[model samples]
Target: MTRELARRDGLFGPIRVLERKHDGARLYCINGSLQTLMLADGVSAFGYVHAAKILVAEAPNVLIIGGAGGSLATMLATRGHSVTVIDIDPAAEQIARDFFNLPPQVRWVTADPLHFITAQEGVFDAVIVDACDSSGIVSPFDKPGVIADLLMKACPRGSLVVNIVAEDGAPPWGGWLAAKLASLGLSVCLFRSEEGWEGNEILHVRVDGPTDRLAITDLEQRPPEARTYLMSLRPHVASHVPVPATSDNGAS
Candidate 1:
């Protein structure tokens, strides 16, 4: 009962709509030999859009991993923030351009985020983690101190956020991962949706300020209905997962 819808957006090379869902239509990029799956309306691109919408300031340097339909990238560009998005899937980049109307201010890099983060030296005002494994895993590349160190080293007195998929009340990584990051001196905050699509976590790591003073209420402020939607996706804060540690520069 599923089929590919034809292209309509001229800006995007070749795009298609898979089907209509509760939130929006599932989208894809059909320009190349490979079919790149894009967004799932209310669900697939929801987390990034919500998070991006509440960003406190316009950042000159920003890095995004797992450009989901380019929602976050587009939103940031519209707000006058320079964005660089890295995705392992070229199809994803095309789909984001074609279907989500991602703008050119959002530079694109087709590469693995882990490798790129390790190899780069540019410090950013913000770093976003939206990477996902094909097997439905979210960033299994854990070395405890690497993420904190990277953000601290690369960001200039700014913040970093990572999205996770878990149930409400789930202890993401049994609280070990978050704790490790905190021990390294990054202010942390957790955000979730009521719909339970994917457990979203927004961890704010401060570079040159008191970590405890960083306020999360601003970025997370939402209307009752919106809060309801956010609460729906709250991963169980106590849920534990097997986060593997990498040695010698985070290479598998």
Candidate 2:
């Protein structure tokens, strides 16, 4: 059941605050399609809930691009991680604070994430990016360029960046995305969140280091949806093996 409780036309686009019976979440669906941000039982109803659990395992210094509802920043800050959110849309700050109960500890900077990161010349232990709008969808932040920029913004080594992709089937996007991350020298683990929105996948990129399997069983601090998704994962990694050399008779 869906009911449009309230809505407003703002700089980012049409923001419709809807009530969903399934999760009891007050969802902010941008332009009647994408559920960009949400709040449930005073907690985040967005993918960041899952992200927070993932970050808790590794990231301490968190830099969030595309502030959106400020859920990610709020979530990380409450966990004692240094959090800073940069968003191009100024309205998001107000919306986040006014609606989502974003905490005061999380700093909000109104600016284009790309420009801000380039100018600051800073590094972070973890970077969480969830910048998507209602219209004109593209490969989660246009994978290549943003991924490259994100990797640079990461610490010298062992820094991880998580990109929440609204993915679909496979092939060009999924396969190509992995290839791009690999080429950029980042070991990537694509966690498909089948329980969340359709085609939801969390791509974790650890710059020049090994990323362990997501601890789904350890879902103490995570949300119900997140725990369900994580629990679905059995914790494993794909091993790449080269073809063995053949001897005299084409058999070694």
lDDT of 2: 0.59
Local lDDT at 61 for model 2: 76
What would the per-residue lDDT of candidate 2 be over residues 1-252, giving only the tens digit for each residue? 978766777565777666777766666666665544454745564443565446445667777777656666776777788888887766667777777778888888998676777787667777766664322123335445567556666555545445444444222233345556676666766555546443445556666566546555546755555555555533223334232222211110
Per-residue lDDT of 117 in model 2: 77
Q: In model 2, where do residues sit more than 4 Å from their true spots?
A: 1-6, 19-24, 36-39, 46-48, 133-140, 166-172, 194-198, 217-222, 234-252
Shift in Å, residue 40, candidate 2: 4.0
Q: For candidate 1, lDDT tens digit of each residue in 1-252?
A: 446655444232444546445534455543431222234432234543455445435466788776746766766777688889987765566767665677877899988776777788676788776653322225443445656766766665676666554444443442455555555555654444546334444544555453322223542543332444544433322223444333332312
Clashes of each: 30, 0
lDDT (Cα atoms) of all candidates against the true structure: 0.54, 0.59
